[model samples]
Target: MKNLSVFSLFLVINISAVFSQNHYGKNGMVASASTYASQAGIEILKAGGNAVDAAIATTFTLAVTWPFAGNIGGGGFMVIHTENGEVTTFDFREKAPFASSKDMFLDKNGKLKSGSNHNTALAIGVPGTVAGLYDAHQKYGLIPWEKLLERAIQLAESGFPLPKSLANDFFQFAEAPEKYPEMQSFIKRDGKVVGFGEDWKQPALAETLKKIQKEGKKGFYEGEIAEALADYIQSQDGIITKEDLAQYEAIERSPIQSTFKGYQLYGMPLPSSGGVTITQMMNMWEQLEETPIIGSVQYYHILAEIMRIAFRDRAKYLGDQDFIEIPELEKLLSDEYATELLEGINFDKAGESTVTEIHSIHEGQETTHLSVMDANGMAVSMTTTLEQGYGVKMQSPDLGFLLNNEMGDFNAVPGKTTNNGQIGTPANTIEAGKRMLSSMSPFIITKNNYPFLVIGSPGGRTIINTVFQTILGTTVYDYPMAQAIEAPKIHHQWLPDRIIYEEYKMAPETLKALEAMGHEIQMRSFLGRLMGIKYNAETEFMEGAADSSSPDGGVAAY
Candidate 1:
């Protein structure tokens, strides 16, 4: 693998520069939501680090540079494929506090208490980011852990101009900070919320990072920082305690493996429905005779139908594997299951459906994803989130970080219809120490035993469909990596029974054709922000692209 580094570097420099919007490099590449974060990963790679090292650097840097989504207070999943052909997954998703209960958010009327679990201290879950990163570094990192913290620490202490995207996010959540005195103090400038382009610094977060750097994971879970976080949450009516933090652990799970059109796909397994849903959708689509043309009416309709079927199963069977009797993966990915699902779809019209007696849980769309690959062929795709923008909309005043409202991800009440019209299943019911079901899907695809595509997105329920479309575009449709990522995407998650697509991203005639087919269509501002890096086997160079929908998304390679 080391011997291939020189050849990769040469190919990266001479790959015809075919895709202008994508960053291409032979030695390494990093695609993330922030330019600074991506550069941080590339720097680690250039400094003789492995893909895992670069991923760690990028993750921490994003915690400082892309606050709304990138985070230290949040939790997520990571899928990694090492050069030696070994694949692994890390489930660092937040867990319910011991005091949490199935009906904690229910009112006296037995209905979900509106906004009770969304933006409050009680919404906070035990954080796992610090623990997860530390575990990953201990296992696979090549650089000193303190080295990765330097950039994030400096950025938090010295401050950086708020990028347009983060600034806009701040502005949108402007009124939120006013409710929490701690948040108000951080964002206020002379009694006004900080505006876009202002220099923003987080001294408190820097201090917290220093502690973690010195004491490893214990610095965050057992020491002064943990005490402060627990005390703050308790004062705010939240259930988090020092014990919850101390008990948090990032588990290394087996990567869900499947094959699509002769290419192998590796994704994060349960706790996340991502891997199963993706594999199921692909299996169903494979039953079709021809790949639908990208952006065409037939294409959208077929994909939407497939998504609907997959999401239905997602709701029915997916959850924390440890707690639920999840369906067998072999059976779910079998051709017979695909055949059974295919029979439910009518290509000529949308299928009629009714809400079932189940619970519908929705994870927030506010999240971040990053993809990194080193010249050695080691690759990583990770999706992390705060559950919502500035999660729970409550910052830990002492910690200078937001707490995850992942508790909202649980089914608050049975027999209730979610805002999206999907019923929640018992499989997702909350329990003490139970991990919430998530829609995050980070994946790595391999061709003939070589790394081919590293991809993932940040779009809550839309993540499965987004990654599905990208894979289809690149593999089945033979589109370039940039085109596959930038192309319009559509989503349909069963109970909703309507195709949601980006406005004007599809041709008017194609949309009209879909309408004629009896499909209900809805327009959305955007569906997802996808980031990916494709390994060009012919050129031996990696090409990375950031979704056009994300204004601040960037790619760096060297």
Candidate 2:
């Protein structure tokens, strides 16, 4: 059967129709890429599920009902803080198959294959997303698993118009139909990509959801689903065997903790570069009350310099702890190290350094981030992905979930540059069962003994910069939840040292000044999505906000 392309579906979302479905006025907020997905979660909360339950429902629903960025076949990182003060980090990151080896993409001549030419089947890591969701439900979900999935299944079966955000993504990905044939059928109509307001549905995906509801995770890993996944991977020349799916498991790990201005911050540890990089940046800025004041060139310059130094360490030391040494990370984020790095910053000029050299310059690794908080105080900050837009652009008929190309995130050549413009580093090379280093940084801030802020973002290397700016927006600039999330953002990722500023809000004169001082300026089509909640412990009141640019952005309170 020929797969449909975005051009052929002629699909487009009717914004008015989607928005008219429901409202999230108060009590428990859900943020996703689309309104249907958010509504799916809000309905769960209305039906008596707690925040964790709502989040669980929303995640699964997004997997089947929204296919651009998430699915059961992908992997993700989640940070959960319970109402009673228990904090746990779930590392459901994808893992390499046992057959994988370092430099798997390198030829006998010692040349690396182009990023586009890398093996798809060989890059499929053992997916832990479904198992991780199940684990979260078992530990914290108040509703029955089947009940939660039912909502998603209903949405998948009945079908809905593609949301404007998803419609935009479909057109954006239409250029490379061969790489992402899975998106073809959904986005195409008359052999062309569909425009906005068109209807879209995945009946096969709906059936897969029903199977999961009836047979639990086994429906995905053991019976028909498992066989389908194996066959699909085999057809694609992928390395994922049935044993990989059956043996996959999600693990709970302790979050890395740090204190900034009396607020305790918790985030995922190594393998997730977010925790360390964020800690380092925060520590550098902790003493900046007298320094980077908002709207000042000195402040922005100082922060950019700090980002340069921290990113230098990030590229070298951050990786899966099981496969590498991460002991230095904790010590590196200490006050002493921060002081040493901060002292080197010059308010008058940019600092020159070698912080942008990553093992893989695989550009544009997109993901989705969501934040949930209910009246019970159960909070979850999660970021999940199919790698880039649909995981290798492949779909399995039996499983009905898009497989991730996460292995493509690593260096194909362990010690040399491949056709891509990157110098190979072994720390991030492929290895059997080893997790890839991820930039997903789901995090929370605590005031006193309770959670004060739950926040995260969805950019690859820009993750650290986006998160850093949001923290500054809330803590330094004293912006409310909405203002903090919507504030104009600026980012410098160490490589180009050129500052990329969001248009309209940033001062043009400031941009010119930075450009004169050796900053490269680039414009992004859209700002990264950031969602979070802020708690005022003194008053016992909570406020939440979602990224304004995202159509599904919203905050709820009771």
Candidate 3:
């Protein structure tokens, strides 16, 4: 494994070419929604940190620079593929508190209660970010933990220039303080929201980081911090307790393993519907009638049709592995099942839509993703979220972070599948200490026993589809990392059955072709904010791309 010193490392952070999605590095590279955080990770890589070390640092830094989804109060998944070809995943996704119930979100008539799942402190699941990062570093990190916290603590104490989008969010919350009682700590310092371009510092968050640096996970999950979290949530009608916080631990799980066209794939498994769904989709693509042509109408049609079927299975079969047994999981990932699934598809016309109207549960699109690859070839793809943007828009004045409304990810009503894309399956029903299902698909692809790509995205239900298409585009269609990342994405979760495409991104003729195929179409401003790195074996360099849809994203490499 080769290492580079900060002063000698040739860092390449080209803001000018970010729109083009072109950035490359010989030793290591990182991509994220925030240029500030990505750059900080690059500095760590240059200072001889491994990918896991840089990823940990980047996650903390995001908690500061991109608080909407980047957070210690939230939880996420991490995928790592070592240079030796071994791969594993970490599941730090939030869990239901011990006091939660299967019918907590239901009313007197057993009907879904509006806002119960996401608009209150009761929606906050016990957080796992601290435990997750600590676990990953303890296993694979080369840099010290305290060193990783330094940048984030400094960023919080000194602050950074406020980006316009973030500034606008604070302004909206500040317009009526009584409407959002807790968000004032973030933007209002003297009763005024921090204006765009001003330095916005968080003194409390810095102190929190310092505690974490000194005492590790206990700094966050025990003693003072833990007491504040439990007492505050209880005060807000939530069920979280200090016991739940202390018992929380990030799990190391086997990644969903599969192969497509000679390339090996490693994806986040179980609690996250991502790995299984993507693995199934990729395996199914191998059984397609013809090779997929990158932007053809036929290509988009095939992806949509496959996604429709896969998502149906997702609604029926996926959940926390710890809670229920998915007997057919092995069979689902089998190549034979993929071939069997193609039997129902009518590429010429369209299969009957299956939008089962039931209890609707959507993971928030505001989640953030980051990718990192150190010089030694340790590649990481991580996705973290706060359920919906500001996450219930609830924050603790003492903790200095927003709490995730992640409990919304659970099926709200049992045994009531509907046509509105609701999945009321018992597997995902609310339960004490159960991890809610997720669509995050952080993954790594390897070619000939070496790292080929590290990729993931933030688009809620669209995540699995986005990841599958990126792999298909880059590996089979021969597209570059940037082109695949910049390409318009297609998504069709089984329940919606409506084909969702990025607005104005598809060719006019292609859109018409899909419509003629009898598929209903919907338009979105964008689908996912993808951040990824693709390896070039011939040149020994890695090419990176950050989603240009979000103006603040960038790639930093050395």
CA-lDDT, candidates in order: 0.83, 0.72, 0.86
Rank candidates by TM-score, best first.
Answer: 3, 1, 2
In the range 1-558, model 3's lDDT, one tens digit per residue, is 012211111121122234656698998899998888898899898888989999999999999999888999999999998767789999999999999998898899999888889888889999999999999999989888999988899999998999998988998988878978888887776666799999998988888889999999989999999999899899898989999999999999999989989999999999999999999999899887788555667777888889988888887888999999999899999999999999888888766664442223577888999999988879999999998988878877777888999999998877777776556788898989899999999989999888898999998998889888889878997668887887777888865667898875666566677788888888998888899999999999999998777768889998
- Candidate 1, after superposition: displacement of residue 153 in Å? 0.6
Considering every candidate listed, which one attains the maximal TM-score? 3
For residues 277-383, could you state the per-residue lDDT of candidate 1 as single tens digits? 89999888888977665555667788878887778778877888888886566788788999988987898887765565232357699889999999998999999
Model 1 pairs whose backbones collide: 358-424, 359-423, 359-424, 359-425, 360-423, 360-424
TM-score, per-candidate, Cα-based:
0.94, 0.89, 0.95
TM-score, candidate 1, is 0.94
Worst 10 residues of 2 by lDDT: 1-10
Q: Candidate 2 lDDT, tens digit per residue, 266-307?
A: 988878888888899999888664744455555556667777
For model 3, what is the error of residue 457's alpha carbon versus the real structure, in angstroms, after optimal superposition? 0.3
lDDT of 3 at 202: 90
Separately for all candidates shown, the number of backbone clashes (residues 3 or more apart, or on different chains) is: 6, 26, 7
Worst 10 residues of 3 by lDDT: 1-10
Candidate 1 lDDT at 20 equals 29
Q: Looking at model 1, how many pairs of residues clash?
A: 6
- Candidate 1 regions exceeding 4 Å error are 1-20, 172-182, 189-192, 357-360, 418-422
